[model samples]
Target: MLRLILIGLLLLVIFPVLASAAKVMSADNSHWSTARRDSTGIAPDPKTTPEAVVQVYAARAFNWRGIFGVHSWIAVKPEKAESFTRYEVEGWGVSSGRESVRIGSYRPPDAYWFGNYPELLVDIRGAEAAALIPQIAAAANSYPYRDRYTIWPGPNSNSFVAHVARNVPGLRLDLPPTAIGKDYRTDGIFGVAPSNTGLQLSLFGLAGVTLALEEGVEVNLLGLTVGIDILTPAIKLPGIGRIGFPQGPS
Candidate 1:
């Protein structure tokens, strides 16, 4: 039984990435720019849009890294607000003594990430968004590893969002299975799940098991997650995200 489980875990880590390698970009898009790419115009225009909006989005990571994981960020617009605030942790500046974590509002929250269309992970509008904004901001600002970053098993981009999710249960978010390194918890080896609704045991992010309402049952091995979304009726894989037709009926 133990060997079977090991084989299953190995397959989960390898098969999806290999199968999806054809779609993963081997190089960064020439159009890689932080500027807005709002061809769909789905992002709310603060001036015309309603009050209190919050959204979480994730896009494939740059270049060959896209084969393995995604980068995620949060955006919030408070009640009667005129604009949205976007927050994310960038790895480029960490080597130069600059903080990797940043917050701004110049670009649309839903903009394509370097030619990759982002997936909307969570959206809360109106009063609920307003109520959550302050807590989210606080959690982002107070993140302990603001200046640090690691591509795997670390305080990378996914870790930031996971931290905020753990702190704010109202979000009820489960980072996508393809979101590698989302289980890197610094507080301790054993603690509550980020969704605040379950228990998790981790070995410094290299391996872990999480049982939660939002996250279901997940096993993380070397930062690759394999899980089942019992509530949503889908099997979550490492690189391909959720399978079993998670997108709804055809």
Candidate 2:
């Protein structure tokens, strides 16, 4: 059986909500912008920070209920979209930090929308600047996914899917493949869009038992998503080795 490993890092920002609601102007542009004057009521300050960019999209990501709802803001100093995208977005951000994380799909086109939104309609969604201060301060400097590369970290089935995609062309595959490994204690937080209440899950060890968890977001299955964070002993399994590859290139 193939193991699957999919990862998403939801950098939860504790930002204050704007008094007004904003619509995403474009459904195609990945890099969005707001004019100096707009109804969203955001200030056009010369100081443009990552938290500022994050503030622009927080309302949208929380309002919509899928991966499409989540967006990225490439950082810039004394920010302007042109200089920002050229110097920072395409350059440093793509290769380092959370910006380095890939969705396995939606490759951004030249300074434009990569996943779903278009350029003309990519307006900024307003957020309270005060709420973002803490989250910005808490963000660490390490690469996002680097934290997950550890000992006995859950089923992480998507790893097998990638291996099969690369090594076994024309070979049919199946979902919910068999898995085996010792279980460990784990902690996680889950929530649906537009809801304040979050469900917390804690798992105790004894591997090979596949536990089913909801994707959390209540939108259509087209954007299905789920996560399992595990903490187990550094034991080796007979079938699944430590971070083993499924019949793929070494």
Candidate 3:
């Protein structure tokens, strides 16, 4: 009986230490994976796979009165790193498709229009793509929706700020929780004729609690400005999309 008790006590002490050691080892492994292998923790090289290049675009118009207005786009690439490794393409076009998506009681069919007319072109390397996708998705779902809402807001702004900081944990900064009472809406659209052509990224669905980090890169383009943000880490979006750290790199 005494021997049994001794062994029990030993396990009680050793088990926690063993568990802690395992956690530490895991953390170290995760760190190495991200730093050395890949920039966004998704795929080391997105351009390496031709399929990695994804194009997202949409367009919509509404009519309120006699006036007919149109908004469209060319393309904008979503990125999580400084450069794209896997994909490069120079394409230009605009999208215009009218639909009745009511914003208020008065549903305009053609007069009211919102879309992007992008002509500038960008190259998305593999590392950059891994980091860019999630931020764009998050921005698409973010709060304080303007005429339309976006996650990264395309490759335009120098910085991407989340109104609800909880949505992106990889940013590695503190963000206050969003207020409870506010009305928010979002729409993603693209025009038919583009002034410039660059890589364009759009979200198809609300993302899960995926692991990611926000990275900003300075950019200059002829007759246009190119700003890029990369999202990092391979993460699974659990029930609540708000950001939090789990064990391991992602």
Candidate 4:
């Protein structure tokens, strides 16, 4: 499985440019220039922080990509720690041989993605987070594709968090449908859902299906996934994300 993933990554590296462009794009590249990436004050400031905490966030990727896909990351603060340590894979510098999978790379556990606000997918605080912080870190450190990055069918940001969730199912993280690259994996195509309650099968991240108590049923076609979250009673469309209920709470 590792060999297969390496081959795919090699293909992406060799083919720096695709023959055809992605069907849809984000609003514009300028969003990254003008949009804010600061802390949203959702996670407690680690300076006077008291207990451990773990949070997972997903937001529309910058630009037209935001209209169809999302980026995801994990943040964990050990008990009595001063600040939160974030883990995510980014594609910004891989072409230059820089490591894309970053641990504690950036902060503000709930920071905005470009100009988009994130939806907290999982929250475990206090004692629970204390217990899980080590395991989460281990998984982040253990990610094999530390230097690989592919915008499509990827080891992109979504895939990184999904890998951690698979490694630590206790998080029970359910990435949104718009997390287009979550299906990509370093292991193999077949694995248990991160929730540990369902089955998932993929084909080099391009095509697959997932069914779980938390994720419901999803079908991936050329990296574009469509599914329904029966538990939430929502529909997961190709580009619109979930429709039916306002996510998170007031």
Candidate 5:
């Protein structure tokens, strides 16, 4: 039984990562500065729409990291706003005394992360978006790891997005399994799932189990996740992400 379990894990988890790593290695963008960061044009045009909007996006992380996980961010545009504000965390400038939490409109709301295209995880508009914007901002501002970042068992980018999702349950954000740090618990080992529909118990984000209405059942081993999303009827793999029905805004 144990051997079968190990084989299943190897097929479901390790193989996907190895396959993704092959593609990452062959990519032309050899350096971060040269990677594509253009907008994917999926976001609503704030200048023309004029409605409050909130969106969450995730993309494969830069370079080799893309093989294991992704970086995610939240973007908001209040009613009548001309631009969007994006909030995310990164480890890049932290060592040089820069805060890990970044808030600004320096880039388009749906800009690619390095050379990787982004996937929208949540979309809320108009009054609903307006109501949730402030709460999301507050959650981002209060992120406990604003000055720290750990790529593995982390308070990294995924952790930031998960934090916001937990605080603003209305978003119904369903972070993918490749979002390695989404289960990190800054306050304690036990807490509500990021989707806020169920409960989770994570040991510093490394090992955990999440059972939620939106998430279904997930198991995290060393920051890699494997599970089944009963809500969407999908299988979540560690490095390859979701497979089955398409998940998007309802």
Candidate 6:
């Protein structure tokens, strides 16, 4: 068993390092201030659609951070609303007393994260979206980490999204393995998975195991996660995320 665990740990470190090296070679070296933040046309226009919509998005984090993980956020558009509201936790300005939880319609709902294109993780529309919008808003507002931000382990952007996902199970959000802070548990070491479909035991997000219908089996080590998705047939890696099949709401 010890040999097996050692082998697993070696694989976890080696694979993510290889993936990160590849990402570095092909990375966009643009400065964050000048990086593209335009919309990718993935979101339905609020004026034209007029239907309630809820979406979860993840994008490679800016600069070198992109090589390791992604930043996740949630956006919502209510029926007949002319704009979408986005909820995300950002580390910027936290030391200056600004809250980490940012809620507004400042940018395009589907805008790129710096230079990284955003991938839609979950999409819900019509009546279902309308019903869940309030709950999502409440979850965002009630997030305990609004005043705190930690890039590794717990209570960062991914943690914020995970909290919202756990509260709104209808989302069935399957955050990718690259969402590094997703396993951070605010309530305790034991809690429901972000998908709310199974259980997870995490030690303040540093290390843990997650098993769920949506997330499959993920082992978190030192804030990095490696796993296999049985339901979707994918191998979840640290830096490169899932390989084999795409995951999203049906």
Q: What is the TM-score of each predicted model, taking all chains together? A: 0.90, 0.25, 0.20, 0.84, 0.97, 0.96
Candidate 6 ranges with C-alpha deviation above 4 Å = 1-7
Candidate 1, 159: how far from true, in Å? 0.3
lDDT of each: 0.81, 0.22, 0.24, 0.78, 0.90, 0.90
Q: How would the candidate models be sorted by TM-score, starting from the highest?
A: 5, 6, 1, 4, 2, 3
Q: What range of 10 consecutive residues in model 3 has the weakest lDDT sum? A: 176-185
Q: Candidate 4 — which residues are off by over 4 angstroms?
A: 1-31, 246-250
Q: On TM-score, who's better, 1 or 5? A: 5
Encode model 5's per-residue lDDT on 48-123: one tens digit a residue.
Answer: 8999999999999988888899999999999999999999998988988889999999899999898799999888
lDDT of 6 by residue, 1-250 (tens): 9999889777877766676868765876788789999999999998799999999999989877887889999999999999999999999999889999999999999999998899999999999999999999998888998779988876899999999998988888989898989999767899899999999999988989998998899999888888999999999888878888898765
Give the Å shift of residue 214 in candidate 5: 0.6
Residue 241 displacement (Å), model 4: 0.6
Q: After superposition, how far is residue 40 of candidate 6 from its true place, in Å?
A: 0.7
Q: Per-residue lDDT of 1-250 in model 1, one digit per residue for the tens?
A: 9999888766887788786576785544565565336634556777887779888888888767788899998889887788778888889879889897889876778877776788887888888888999999999987889779999878888889988888888887778888877888857788888778898998978899999987889999888888898877789888888886453111
User: How many residue pairs clash in each candidate at the backbone level?
Assistant: 0, 23, 59, 6, 0, 0
Error of 2 at 225 (Å): 6.4
Clashing pairs in 6: none
Candidate 2 lDDT: 0.22
Give the residue spans of candidate 2 off by over 4 A: 1-54, 58-111, 115-131, 140-144, 147-196, 200-250
TM-score of decoy 3: 0.20
Better of 1 and 6 by lDDT: 6
| Best candidate according to TM-score | 5
lDDT, residue 84, candidate 5: 96
